[model samples]
Target: MEYRPYKPVNLTAAGRDYAVAMVRRHRLLETFLVTTLGYSWDQVHDEADRLEHAASQTLIERIDALLGHPDRDPHGDPIPTVEGHTHRPAHAIRLADAAPDIYRIARVSDADPARLNRFSGHGLRPGQTVRVGEREAGELTISLPGNDQAPLVLAPEETKAIWVSPAASAGLRGPASI
Candidate 1:
């Protein structure tokens, strides 16, 4: 239980293990809720938050097995393995930082439910391919597959809230798995 003044504290080995276990529980619950229970990405956080504290390890493991050991949640965040290993997408970049090209949606921040709902309304979810156009006036223009090539004008917050990777690098064809 030692910490430096005015510095971010690093977790001890035991603390890290506990944190990882909780994260595993929460993420497994989130994936189960989304994949099995038909819950949307935006709706699983609160439910997972409540359930993570109460869910037993056996239950979480069962849920993970039922999911066929998915490595990512609905929002594309990596799910830690039983050994506490996390595999992050090596090439993921912020949507704001992406060059003008076609890219697969790698991840989206679930921090803002209203914004998440808006994104969902626009059919912007993980694994969806989007065409990133040039940025203008502090906003970025992005286009989906349909919509007659109309661009979705997004503020900086919207752009920063998403993550994308080279669509070709991942071998993701026509909006692959979520």
Candidate 2:
């Protein structure tokens, strides 16, 4: 147990290993809570935080297996592999900055449960499709694919927490997004 100042970039080998293991446990717990226990994405972050430090490695592994080894957590954050590696998407951009075109909801932040609720109320989720409408007066409008639903309006800050990527034309032809 060494008392060293925190240096995120230049960690010692042992420090880095411990850091990675902790992060892996936290993420796996989040995935498991969401997938197996039906916890919403916004609810898992705090729950994982409380359990990660106390849960044993064996319990974490069992949970991972139960969830079929999910690669992403409920909010679409990558879960570190058993080897501590993470893969990030290359083209994800904030919905606020996305061009006025069709985009698929890639990820939403878990930092704000209220915002997550708002997104859920509008049927926004990862892999769901949305059309980027106009941005005006610090708000962004997005059209959801439904005959009866109106467009969803979000604040700029809320829009920034959402990531989207260009949806494939063929994928958009499905009944949900077409």
Best by TM-score: 1
Q: What's the true lDDT of residue 100 in model 1?
A: 86
* Per-residue accuracy of model 2 over 64-161 as CA lDDT, tens digit each: 88888887777877888888888766778889888787887878888898888888887888877888889899898888876377787889899989
Instruction: List, residue by residue over 1-178, the lDDT tens digit for candidate 1.
Output: 4599999888999899889989888888999998899998889999999999988878998998999999888888888999999998789999989988788898999888889899998988888888888999989998888667467999999999999988776675544432
Candidate 2 runs further than 4 Å off: 1-9, 169-177
TM-score of each: 0.91, 0.86
Among all windows of 10 consecutive residues in model 2, the one with the lowest summed lDDT is 169-178
- lDDT score of model 1? 0.87
Worst window of 10 by summed lDDT in candidate 1 = 169-178
Quick one: how many clashes does candidate 2 have?
0
What lDDT score is found at residue 36 in candidate 2?
Answer: 76
The Cα RMSD of model 2 versus the native structure comes to 3.2
- lDDT of every predicted structure (CA atoms): 0.87, 0.81
